[model samples]
Target chain A: MKLLAALLSGVLFGVGLAVSQMTNPAKVQAFLDVAGAWDPSLAFVMAAALVVSSISVVLARRRSQSLLGEPLQIPAAATIDLRLIAGATLFGVGWGLGGLCPGPALAALSTGVPEVWVFTASMLAGMLSYRWIFRVAPIRE
Target chain B: MTEFTPVSATVGGLMVGLSAGLLLLLRGRIAGISGIIGRALSQPLGDGGWRLAFLVGLPIGAAAVSLATGRLVVEVAASTPVLVAAGLLVGFGTQLGDGCTSGHGVCGIARGSKRAIAATLAFMTSGAITVFAVRHLLGASS
Candidate 1:
């Protein structure tokens, strides 16, 4: 049941990415380009998402257990750490450079584009290298 | 460049939110792409069945969307090496930050997390700055 729910959620999320043009690199890049050709379409998407999620989170937090009788898994860390800022800054540079993030980039894989292949492979390698280099479990900071 | 797809964008945003809401309501998990993927990579012996399932669904859902709508995402014009470099940075930085666009930008902000707010601000500012550097200063048309 848990697995099925997750799979369905993923499907819905992917479809959203595709339909919202979040999968479009140029659109995403344009959104980031305040100093260049700016596009504000993504702002609507982000706003809509935030509003709905906010409602769900607020309502769900009122209950101790989820619909599946599982304990809520909200992130516990509250500290504003150096790693978070630095990593986010680096991620932003990457995002600006390629106009790709994990979700949209993964969805792009279905298009069978070569650049998508390169980015995806490199991302996987990057994830693997984090494991190899640090030898410590990656945790939220 | 305010692309006028407000209708579709809002509808799609609702779907994204619905999916995220379902994940949180039914499964009690954040529907964060980077965190899920990163954990899947770093934890070989950990629970990952759902993560793999979700990951598999992403492409399937994308394919379905394209088939139905007859609209495909724009081909990213960056060179292979640049794409590779971008991917590496995204993956590595996300792991270090413990979240990415979906995790922090959507879910974290929705919950009014102070740390998440700060992180989101940092990333957005940096993203804008990077865009300025690449698109304006470097003059790359892609």
Candidate 2:
């Protein structure tokens, strides 16, 4: 049941990416294109997503236990530090240049676009490099 | 005659929300691109299989959708060097922050994670600034 639910969710997320035209790196780049031919459509999509997500969360919490038979795991930290700021900046630059973040980029691969693979490969390398550089301690749930 | 369907942003958003929520509920994991990609990179014993499956599935899903609807549009205006640099930076950031927007902004916030809230705020601010600098200052565009 859990596997089915997770898979279903993944499919739904993919569908959302498709319908929003977010799977298209061009549209995302348009949003980043502030100076010439700037497009704010992605903002609208994000805003719409935020509203729905906020509401769904409120309702979902009313349940005693989630469908997978476990409580929701929330992050324990609360402060904003150099790590957060630096990370955000890095992520933003990537989004601006590549026009693909993790979700959409991964989704784009299914389309068999060569660029997507290149982007994903680099992203994976980046992720791995972090473990070596930062030496992240094992995260305990 | 073909039926006229409304482009429901609400429905689209709801579907995305549900998908993220469901993943959290079942896998005890946030549907974060960075984190998923991160785990895939480690290639730990018994790890690569699922990660490979997940990674492989993403592109396949898009391909299937494109086949069903129409061709998927892909645009990359940045030079290869710039794209590579950006990818490296994001990887560093995802690691330092311990989560991406999907994990923090969506999943973490939903679970009432204060850290996620802070991280999400930082993510948005940086994104806005990058847009300003690249588009306004540097003259980069799609």
Candidate 3:
């Protein structure tokens, strides 16, 4: 049941991303191209998602366990550090270049695009390299 | 600004939020794509089944909409080498940061996590600057 819920949630997230044009690299690029011919459509997506998530998170946090009785596993890292900033900076540079992040890249997998394959493979390799080098240290539990 | 689709974008955002929110409320987990993927790759046995299920569902979910509406269009605009570099950067950077837009932007902000907020700001600024430099200053569209 829990697994099913997780799958359903994933499906919902994917559909949402697809519907919002988040799967399109061009659309994302346009959104990020604030100084140029900018597209503000994606901002609405982020805003709407945050509104719903903020409310839900507030409600869910009061409970020690989830509705399914799983221990809440939200991030527990409490401090801001150079690692966080530096990592996000690198991710952002890549994001600006390709307009594909973890979620959209995964969601676009079934499209069978060669470029997606390249991006996905490289992204996975990157993840694996970090794991091998860093030993998958839990940055924050 | 001209390519804006407020209705669909808002609806999609709601869906994304619903997914993230539901995951939190039901499983007490952050719907963080990078974290989940990393775990799926290296986590211990009996620990990665759900992550796999979630990851599988990502493509399947998008595929369903494409099959039904036949409206989804996909093409990676960047060159193969560019895409590879971007992917590698994203993959490594997300791991090092411990979150991406979803983790830090959506789930973390919703929870009022300072680290998530800080990380999100850092990435947004970096992304904007990179775009300006690459697309504007450098004129390297590819």
Q: Pick the candidate with the highest lDDT.
A: 3
Q: What is the C-alpha RMSD of each candidate to the true structure, in Å?
A: 1.6, 4.4, 1.6
Per-candidate DockQ versus the true complex? Answer: 0.76, 0.43, 0.79
Lowest summed-lDDT stretch of 10 residues in model 1 chain B?
A: B39-48
**Best-first order by DockQ:** 3, 1, 2
Error of 3 at A48 (Å): 0.6
lDDT by residue (tens digit), candidate 1, B5-39:
88888888888888889999998889888889987
| Model 1 segments more than 4 A misplaced | none
Candidate 2: regions farther than 4 A off:
A34-36, A138-141, B1-11, B43-57, B111-114
Chain A only: list TM-scores of all candidates.
0.94, 0.91, 0.95
> In model 1, what are the clashing residue pairs, if there are any?
none
Q: What value does the interface RMSD of model 3 take? A: 1.4
Clashing pairs for predicted structure model 3, backbone only: A38-B1
- The lDDT values for all models are 0.84, 0.65, 0.86
Candidate 2, pairs of clashing residues: A87-B93, A109-B59, A110-B59, A110-B60, A110-B63, A111-B63
> In angstroms, what RMSD does candidate 2 have relative to the true structure?
4.4
Instruction: Tell me the docking grade of candidate 3.
Output: medium
Q: Write the per-residue lDDT of candidate 2 for residues B1-142, one digit (tens) a residue.
A: 0111125334545556766665655544566656666765665324324344444545555666687778766766667777777677667677667777567766666666777777777766666667667667876543
Which scores higher on DockQ, 1 or 2?
Answer: 1
Model 3 / residue A5 / CA error / Å: 0.4
